[model samples]
Target: MSLLELRAVSHGYRQGGLFAPRTAKSVLRDASLQIAPGECVALLGPTGSGKSTLGRLALGLERPWAGDVRFDGAPLHDRRGRIAPVTRRAIQAVFQDPHGATSPRLTCLEVLAEPLRAGSTGKAALRDQATALLRDVGLDPALLDRLAHRLSGGQLQRLCIARALAPAPRLVLLDEAVNSLDLETQALVLGLLRELRRRRGIAYLFVTHDLRLVKGFADRCYVMQDGQPIEVADPFGPGLVPPAMAALRAAILPALPGPRPLRQPAAANAVLP
Candidate 1:
């Protein structure tokens, strides 16, 4: 059974709207997809293709303009337009910017513990779990005292993952999570995601534009164009892919560039202070 489903969802944002016969610029039109337990699926598309919008829909952060969003076979939102606490905890997201994902004012330990406080776990256990989770994601417990701003992107992102996992979510939405990191950091984060999945049976929805990243990381890939899933193909299967996607894949697949020159971080080695 699918853990989450977006059934024929259509959504858009209002344009020129301050009372001028509001018009919506449609982004997702009849878009649908699913993620099953323990599966690593990807929503692949270039910028402005509405991948992030779909990610928000999947995370129950927003309701579609039309169609239903289901989690574990139930509607994600109630008639009151409120999401259940379980749904909120079950569907967590880690976005492109770790700096944005975590609160700069909070220490690493506080950030990780924030999610767990909603649970029944005692305070001491929460701290222990936070420490263990940090270590699991390849960080030192000492860093827990550091503010989120103190760590590099890679370390902070790992901290983000730990915070997301604190609630023991069933599905994780990695929305371009590695797009901001250096090549080495990206590789490490990807490996950490794989390891976490292997150990915890967690499923991942990798939202990205890099076909190279999707090609090796995801089991099933959905290529999006103009906010619709046009092609659903297996990354490893040669016969299943379409010719156009194949050609584009060939063009961009050769060398998956790491972080570009100017944007590259000074240290991506999971550095600690």
Candidate 2:
């Protein structure tokens, strides 16, 4: 069975002023996809293309107006009208903004330990586990004493990833989690994520706007436009084979200078739009 599956899922949002007639804007239209255990699938699209909405649907933060989302063959909707704790724990998310994800008042240790506290684990064990998780994410143990505000963006992102892993979740929903980091830090985190997937057999629903990164890292890719998925392709295929989605993607890439300079160019500027 697939680790996670979305069958004919559809969702929308109400727009216009609250007093005005609420116009329903459909974002996802009959979307269906699956991710197997240990698989890394990337959702690629431009901004406002509903990639994050899909992530939210997968995490049960938002429910689909139609169709179903299943985890290990169980429907994601609350059974008996209540979300099962076990089900909630199986899926975790790492958001794009690390600072927003981490509590400013909480130290790194407390942030990581939050998951364990919710998991019925003892305090001592939680601290030990949190420390181990932070180490696994390539953060030094001493940082645990520092508050979220004291850490760099990359460090906080690592902590978010660590916290997601604290429950030892079966799947991780990463919504542009690497978009805010420097190239060096992004590369390191991507490599670490790959290693973690190999070691833990965890599945990933990686959402991002960077087609280049998706092509290199994802096993499969789904291209979305205007709140709908337009193409699905294997990442290992021949170059630029997403013919149907090529124009959309080509339009987004900035025009490069002819005969690009080499010798290890500096990283591209960070701009999330």
Candidate 3:
């Protein structure tokens, strides 16, 4: 069975004046997708295209107005039943901003320990697990005493990833998780994610707008347009070869510098009024 499945799922937001009858602005329209165990699927799209919404749906943050979202053949709705505590630990997320994800008041040790504490694990075990996770993400165990505000953006992002892995989740949702980092940092985090997946057999739903990044990083890619998935393809396929999708492809490639203005022949050292 697919690890995660969204079958004909649809969702919308109720907006406008509350006094008047509110209208539901649909963001997802019968969206269907599936991710198998140990497979990393990248969801690519422009802004307002429902990529984040779809991630939320997969994480059981929002209920679909139609259809069903299932994990291991069971629906994710409350009526069907809440996800078991053990099952909940199997699905975790790392969002776009690490600063926002990590508590400013918490040190790295505290941040990583929180999940284990919540899981009722012993403090000694939590410390060992958190230290190991930090090491796995290429961070120094000594840095664990530093507060969130003291770390660089890249370090903070890695911390968030480590925290997500603390529960030993089988699937990790990365919702534009690396968008705010520099190119070097982005590459580092991406490499770390890939390595972790290989070593741990963890699956990922990588949502982002950079198709170029996905081209080389993802095994498969799904394109979303206006809240709907328009295309899905293998990274090596012609799915991104069409003219209509060219813009997205181009956006992902290394940006070229604009042409430099021509010099005015040095003006012969004369001053002009």
Candidate 4:
């Protein structure tokens, strides 16, 4: 069974002033997606293609105008139209801008400890947990004392990722998580995420516009257009790229100079008990 599923979901935003008649600007139309446990699925699309909007629907940040968002076979919102705490904790997200993801005033330790504090009450225990999360994301635990604004882009992004994992989530929505970083940092963060997945068996909805990054990173890729998936392809398989994907590839601006290779995590630190 899929860990996260969106079936024929349609969503839109209201646009207009109080004096003018409000109209729904449709962003998603009959969009369906699924992420099985331990699977990496990419939603590939360019800007204004409704990729992030679809992600918001999946996150239950906004109710879809149509269709259902289900997690582990149950509706994301219950009959009473409320998300359960377990469901909230089970699904997490890491967005593109790490700087904007959390409060600038928060220290690195505090950022991670925020999620972990729900279960563990002691400060020392929380510190230890936060330290471990930093280490898990290949960050230096010594930086825990540093304020979020003081950290570099890569460090802050890694810290944000560590926070997402603090909840022990089953599914993570990575909405262009590495897109804002430098090429080298993007590769590093991607490698860290891959390692975490291997250790935790977590499913990821890896949303992005970069097709090259999806090559070895995603098991399956969904090419979205105008709020819906127009094509689905297996990234690792030997087959012709779908028309939509081909077009997207052609449109890419060669950000990596020559050949852009998706980074793979080192084998030695891949698995953990």
Scored by lDDT, model 1 comes in at: 0.85
* Residue 92 miss distance in model 4 (angstroms): 0.7
Residue 119 displacement in candidate 1 (angstroms): 2.2
State residue 96's C-alpha deviation in candidate 3, in Å.
0.9
Q: TM-score of the candidate numbered 2?
A: 0.87
Misplaced by over 4 Å in model 1 are: 19-21, 120-122, 235-251, 254-273
Model 2 residue 158 CA deviation (Å) reads 0.4
- Which candidate should be chosen as best, given TM-score against the real structure? 4
TM-score against truth, every candidate: 0.87, 0.87, 0.87, 0.89
Which stretches of candidate 2 lie above 4 Å from their native place?
Answer: 79-81, 234-244, 251-273
**Would you give me the overall lDDT of model 4?**
0.87
lDDT string, candidate 1, 34-58, tens digits? 8899999988777887899999899
Tell me the tens digit of each residue's lDDT in model 2 across 47-111. 88788888989998888999899989988876554557888898999999998887789998888
Q: What's the lDDT of the predicted structure labeled candidate 3?
A: 0.85
lDDT of 1 at 146: 85
Looking at model 3, residue 231 earns an lDDT score of 56
lDDT of 4 by residue, 1-273 (tens): 988889999998999997999898999999999889999999988788899998988898888999999999999998877899989998899999998898988899888888898895699989999989899998889999989879999989999999999999999999999988999999999999998999999999999988778877888889886678765656334577666676776677444477769897778867665
Give the clashing pairs for model 3: none
Worst 10 residues of 3 by lDDT: 235-244
